[model samples]
Target: MNPALIERLQAVDRQAESMGRGERSAYLKQQAAELGMSLATLYRKLEAVAVKPGRKRRSDAGKSELSLDEAKLISAVLMEAMRRNGKRLMAVRQAVEMLRANGKIEAARIDEETGEVLPLSESTIIRALREYKLHPDQLLQPDPVSRMKSEHPNHCWQIDPSLCVLYYLPRHGKDTGLRVMKEEEFYKNKPKNVVKIEQDRVWRYTGTDHASGTIAVRYYFGGETSANLCDFFIYMMQAKQDTLKDPFRGVPRMVMLDPGSANTSAAFKNLCKSLDVHVQINRPGNPRAKGQVEKANDIVETAFESGLRFTEVNDIDQLNGLAERWMRYYNGTQIHSRHGMTRYQAWNKIKAEQLILPPPADYCRELAVSAPKEAKVSPDLEIRFGGRVYSVKDIKGVLVGQKLLVAKNPWETDGARVATFDADGHETWVAVPQVVFDEMGFRADAAVIGEEYKAPSHTESQQHAKELDKLAMDAETLEQAAAKRKGKAVPFGGELDPYKHQEDTLAARNTLYIERSGQQMDYNRMEVAEQVLSKVEMAKLLKPRIEAAGGDWKQAVALITKQYPDGVAASQLEAVFNQLKTAGRLKLHKTA
Candidate 1:
């Protein structure tokens, strides 16, 4: 049945015809040599041909003769070609040579393209030559064509689950909550949830914008189970509008996916409806369609985050912060020669050159929420640098009763400030210079011992150092104070009785709150002792007979600064206009 096998058979026949009379062994040996066949193959071929009644010689075997119709079928095909071209054509010659090579009939012609084979030598070819027909001048060949390419971002995306784990928790009696923390023999001995969700190593849903090369990557850090899949799909669904310039624009045309519940859900389809992205499941065990994204996962999980050592992180907030920073860096700065530019650059540069994806008309759009109000800051202004707000017992000090500036730190932007603190631990009426905070010292940083240390404010540090100079506390007390201050909490109010120790309380509360009740206080008493600036509930204004300058805090503070270390008394009328800015509003350029 194989064409090569037929050629070998024909070759064997040619060699056999050259054999002398009664030279069966010589013929077999010649076949073994010429065809480079073993003795077994030669014997098999000889046996196949020698199928005369039972051990008849191959030459004496009675062959199943061809019928008149079959012989004529072959002859007609050959004869028709000959009549058309006198066997001078290449196809005709090849046909005749093929017939002769197989001993169908002895075909021969003067080394011509088309060979005329008379059927005198073999009835098979002679009968076919009698009527066989074919148009021998025709030729056919195939042409090459170009393949199609994707046109735009999100043309295709790929998703997969890379790892999985399982865990079990033994059930415990409900009395676990009745115990106290200090009473427990060991924290590990406490009973927890009876069932623990199986965690995967790290599953990623990475959406890559094919045209721009931008990516939205998220990790499955929790129960990457069915429930998590639902959440992931929901979030991805919401991303449809956020990611596109037009919510009605095209979605990821194709999603090449691996076998993962997160990727296979109808819920996912419902979400994709907002953008109309489609899904394409990969063949079982075939990951070729997602090779690029898989490679990207490797870079992120292993090479970028860390080197294959899957260390657990503390929290999601931290992870998101890190991811945000990395995304900003990757999109705006990282240059990739393959994509012709950075992701952001590509997104901006690509135009009609990009592949166009027709969006679904019914695709819904999502509007982003309004941005939070931003607080303007003076370049040198001071403010807190964290997000949590705290409640405090009112501590009397410089911040009490007086109007103060409340603005965000330009560099930190974590929290707004009600007032600024002086170098000394006192709350003073001065603008804060938002210095770059690199406070590496810890409250109990043992390694930070022996150095001349500074606490949060210059005043506290100088006072503490003074104590150190006075040698009041031995190394033991030094260690204790060092432990408390070094740990970062400038504590006060709740534990320390503010009424009994107002100065110390003010020193600890970091922030200064003004008192509303009327009171009289010394100008520098905030640093010296308990002092509360009182609020002016109502005031009557009258035009002065003499020429007077306008009201401005800076002009006043600058004039006060002229009295350096002994500024003019807070009670003096020459206190450089002690009045608020007109309209109780601020103009940043003038302030700056």
Candidate 2:
């Protein structure tokens, strides 16, 4: 293996090759004796040092006995048997065996020389799976993500909630104090201890500005709830009093968050609707969509919450206060890697129009409870809400009689927002102003009475109705259909019988009457007559008045006798009763 030995062997081989066959053999024997090694050993050393041509590749070297399709079937079976955490529950051998038993895969090769039928082994199948990139290891990797950006600060924000495993606030007597949850006291073995303080488990809510990477964190006592999420969101939106300490506050154009129940709650969505903030809920099982807030949670845990172990914390308020202070310092001083500037500096670049200040906290809280109500778009392209009508003519793709979700717009006193879906099926809130009316109770935008005339544009419903008319009436257009029928065409091509049910009922009744009476009934003499109230009925009606009148029935009886000697007509009872009351005949005393 030494360079000198290799050179010596090469020289001996060159000299031996120059001699005749018998002389070359004698020369190699002489060299082997001189080297004190056997002739076979010398030949082996020479062969090791000799330069040989590269190994000849077969015509089907990369081809496998297991076909790509068969390998894919095996891979799919293994993948289906994998846990969500990417751990494979079924190995390649087990999967291959099961697939073979199920007759789902047939990967075999026939030897060209021997003509032998050879089935692919597990190793061959696994190799083919790798070659075709069908293995679970290759398929279960995290999806590739592209960099996302916002045009300006507050353009987009990401929020996420995480349970703080390090600490919990347990109530001692009447007051709650921060307590560290050690593994020894609260582990998998101690289920009761975990449940005992379930209500007291601390949850950290984190929000991050996508463009500036500004972070806002708040600690809550309980788990993720709509109230806590809304509270944290309001805190992020509301301007801080101490601007010198923290100034990152404004309603974002869009908010990206995980699709948790609390995050998708009606109250939280209503809050966003009122603020004109777009809620972008990431798809389930896709946390990377809101990776900013997820990372912020980790940063808060490491840089902020980790120090809580050394410091004293009394209650959730104090803990939040400490968190707020840390967030302000972190955002104001720490330079963000994305922009190479502090978060405050980056956020300060926001234009006045882009930075929309939120309403007061109380108004936001009120708005949170204002869930969207379904309102139908009227024929006049309007929706009624809160005793007022709002015009939907400006809303794109709006149609008459179409239902829309509407909620109160907190920014506008009399305006409401209509929840609409984009082409991508994402819910968006559009602010719709209330219709203004003149003093004459007419629309302010209405055309003048005589000077000018304005014809409203045709709605989607009208266009569809035209199409429907063509289909239903078998005509080229609505005008043709109208001219054909002269405004008297019945629906369904006039094939429908409108009074068939009524006719059937009358026929059945006639048959029953004839069967029971053994003859046709006389319809000409039948008549309906109104009946008058009986004396007993009149007395019952006047009983309450008579009782209130100190059991004086003489006045009531005298009036009834004078009004009608027979009986009082039911239609005239109200008028006659009122006359008796006004005539001081049925006066009732009021008790103190």
Best by TM-score: 2
lDDT of 1 by residue, 312-426 (tens): 3444444544554555566667686677687767665545433334322222211011111223322222222333331111212322123443433222334333443546754
Candidate 2 local lDDT, 1-592, one digit each (tens): 7888789999998898789999999999999999889999999998887777799999988887787778888888888888878888998988877877899876778889999988777777878888898888888888899888899999999999988988988865765667678898888478898898889899999999999999999888779999999998999999997976687998999898888999999899889877878889899998888888888988999999889888778888899889888988899999988799999889888999998988899889989987778999987799999999999988988988889888988878888989878899877788987899999999999999999999988877778888887776778877878776687766667776889899999988886434454677777776777779976788778768666755456777777777777878788777766676677656645655
The ten-residue window of minimal lDDT in model 1 covers 537-546
Best model per lDDT: 2
lDDT of 2: 0.85
Which runs in model 2 stand beyond 4 Å of their true positions? Answer: 1-38, 45-51, 172-175, 421-426, 436-456, 463-592
Candidate 1's C-alpha runs over 4 A off are 1-148, 164-202, 222-250, 307-312, 350-592
Candidate 1's TM-score reads 0.28
lDDT of 1: 0.44
TM-score of 2: 0.71
